[model samples]
Target: MKYKHKYSLTPIAIAALVAFPTAALADGPYVGVSGGVVLPEDSSNAGEFDADVPATPDFGAIPAGTEVGWETQFDTGFAISGQAGYAFENGFRLEAEVAYSEYDVDTHTGLTVGGANIDGADVAILTRGAADPANPTVGAVIADGQGKVTNFGLFGNVFYDINTGSAFKPYVGGGIGYQWVDVDYMPSGVAVGADEDGTFAYQLMAGASFEVSDNFEIFGQYTWRDSTEEAEIPLTLVPATLGVESSQSIISAGVRVGFGG
Candidate 1:
């Protein structure tokens, strides 16, 4: 059994600065921070056994190496970010940001052996490497344990503050970045197998802000990001890569403070 985290309060906003943009807030330097909920899409073909497996007591033999696929389902998670940038009087702004996010695994889906789908204890048997004389057969212990995906990212962004009249303002922008994706999973046994790597990534965002004064503004936005390549997580016993790509949607709100001209 797993305890999935739930978010009852909706996100208030998200923000990004662009090089060629129109904006408001402050004319000089500013810093911001935000936190919110994250929902990760299901991943297909996350990874596979890099080599051939002879046979296991729980499941039969599998051949053709990479054709053996691994898919996964994930529960809702959380995300946070901090950024520093300068807003121009002309409305264009450029900034840098760092963010982190995590998701819990619901189950390992779409595992197959000899053209038939395998699940429950059978999936664990193969993942725990039943073929290995060192590992005994693991019966029916799927998702009774733990698994998750963790990510760290850094980005250079641009945003434009749109003129909406009064204290309310809307902004839109995007950026390019790098991501470190990590996977740790143990579906069938007590031991855990993990893998992590870095990749090229990018995101698009939009949000609105309300100016409370000359130096402070409250804001929120929705952000979507994806990796150019898949995350390959290789583990022992499993003998395969968990090929989940780093992708997520974030709903968040934060405050920005400006100083100097």
Candidate 2:
């Protein structure tokens, strides 16, 4: 009798075979680009006085031996980034990225000279006068010296993909990187001028991706990044130091294209 040897495939084994193709299609090498609206936080200790600066009469009430300083704010800025990475079938990814960002000065405030607050004036006037006390034109233009702060960076990042067994994947990740962005915007006009560029940095992010095709996805993300060190740039017009520290909040969206799994 040709009756036969009974044949059986377990449920788990059958399911695995059926799911193999989808798993393979879901992970691979990918590249992405994104843009963001950036909001920058204020940095303190923006300027300080030292002995080399003459106690000039041009600076109103800001004599020598006065510690020069101010706080700052930025208008809404923009950021762009590009990255390449490999995604594993087990739900992990590694990427390398390059990014750039820029912001326009909104205003300067909290002018403290010799530890005294110079209130009731446009902070720009105070900063300009303090920087170039000899220039009588200083402080007249409330809108003068509208400078910008810019950034360039390289980063290595790692991410964990939360697989929902469907078209959507949510993720959380962080990275450590280096930035070349230490110039002081207020002084840049008189001085790209106030700076000590390059510092260690770090960031944290949360995002979600929607698959547009088997090998393509669109994502939205929110990130917070900060420089781990303070940068001090020597003032060109005066005997003073401009101290800058950076922190930012970003909301962005991008697309990723994938290759072989």
Best by TM-score: 1
TM-score of each: 0.79, 0.76
- Alpha carbon lDDT of residue 70, candidate 1? 53
**lDDT scores in order:** 0.74, 0.72
Off by over 4 Å in 2: 1-25, 56-66, 119-145, 182-192
Candidate 2's TM-score: 0.76
- Those runs of model 1 whose alpha carbons end farther than 4 Å from true positions after fitting are 1-24, 55-61, 113-115, 120-140, 143-145, 188-192
Give the Cα-based TM-score of candidate 1 against the true structure: 0.79
Which candidate number maximizes lDDT?
1
Residues 208-236, candidate 2: write the lDDT tens digits: 98876667789999989888886666766
In angstroms, how far off is 134's CA in candidate 1?
Answer: 20
Q: Looking at model 1, which ten-residue stretch has the lowest summed lDDT? A: 13-22
